[model samples]
Target: MPDGPHTAPAATPPLCEEEIARFVVERFLPGVDTGDLDPEYDLLATAVIDSLGVLHIVGWLSKQYGIVLPDRELASRNFRSVRTILATAERAAAVGAQP
Candidate 1:
């Protein structure tokens, strides 16, 4: 893992929870209130992000990892925290890898 603001991993696999958190905070949360953007932060409740932002994240995951997430899977549980996001991404990646 390359240090200094990790985005989705390129060679290895999908981004992990910690890397997702760093990416979201460093890339997406800039100019937003940092006080409410903790690791366990409820992104929806805090209004730290919206539905469009979740779509943006989904797009990024697809582009970066070739994991396309369908609209039906886009829910608050999947995008609520870094852990959840990584889990969702991993699931998508696994599905993509299947023959």
Candidate 2:
């Protein structure tokens, strides 16, 4: 008991990969089992998410990250897999954080 401020280090926000995976599993999947949706799995080919789901995911991402994703950037190449989504989110976050 010899501390003045007793301040703790600030915690960093989750990385892109972590954010994307957590959002998908927790928000998108809801009650469904997430065992089948591997991080590296092909979201489109495997039908893990459909068109409407994509929109939902995009909206969720925008809302959660405070980044608006245009439709042109909402292609399969950007949101096809977890890795891609992570990359996209990272880029968006970087840009959004810029003054």
Candidate 3:
């Protein structure tokens, strides 16, 4: 059988806190000013992210980072705020990138 096309690995775009914040604003809280989003804002407590919203976020995170989020990891704590979400995404990406 012929081997897969021998192409070099594609470059991964940089992941930054600003990007995460922007994504949150655009995806979850559309029409909200990006500057108003606090990194420590409690999305769940404030009703910004509900049960269905969490599913949307999980789907976005999976497709965006190419990482799989286990059912157990989908806790309020992990999706508490922009900072927490970024941390979770980075960790998941790292784990997924490993052999």
Candidate 1's TM-score reads 0.71
What C-alpha lDDT do the candidate models reach, one value each? 0.74, 0.73, 0.81
Sort the predicted structures by TM-score, highest score first: 3, 1, 2
Model 1 stretches with alpha carbons more than 4 Å out: 1-14, 31-38
List, residue by residue over 1-99, the lDDT tens digit for candidate 1.
666886674484437766576667766787654444566778777776688879878887876667898676798789987667888888877777889
Model 1 / residue 1 / CA error / Å: 33
- Candidate 2 CA-lDDT value: 0.73
lDDT of 2 by residue, 1-99 (tens): 766968896765565666676667786667745555667878777776778778877887776666777666778778788888877777777777889
Query: Once model 2 is optimally superposed onto the true structure by TM-score, how far is the C-alpha of residue 2 displaced, in angstroms?
Result: 32
Candidate 1 positional error at 9, Å: 13
Clash pairs (backbone) in predicted model 2: none
What TM-score would each prediction reach against the true structure?
A: 0.71, 0.67, 0.77
- Tens digits of lDDT, candidate 3, 12-46: 55666676778789978899998889999998899
How many residue pairs clash per model?
A: 0, 0, 0
Error of 3 at 21 (Å): 1.7
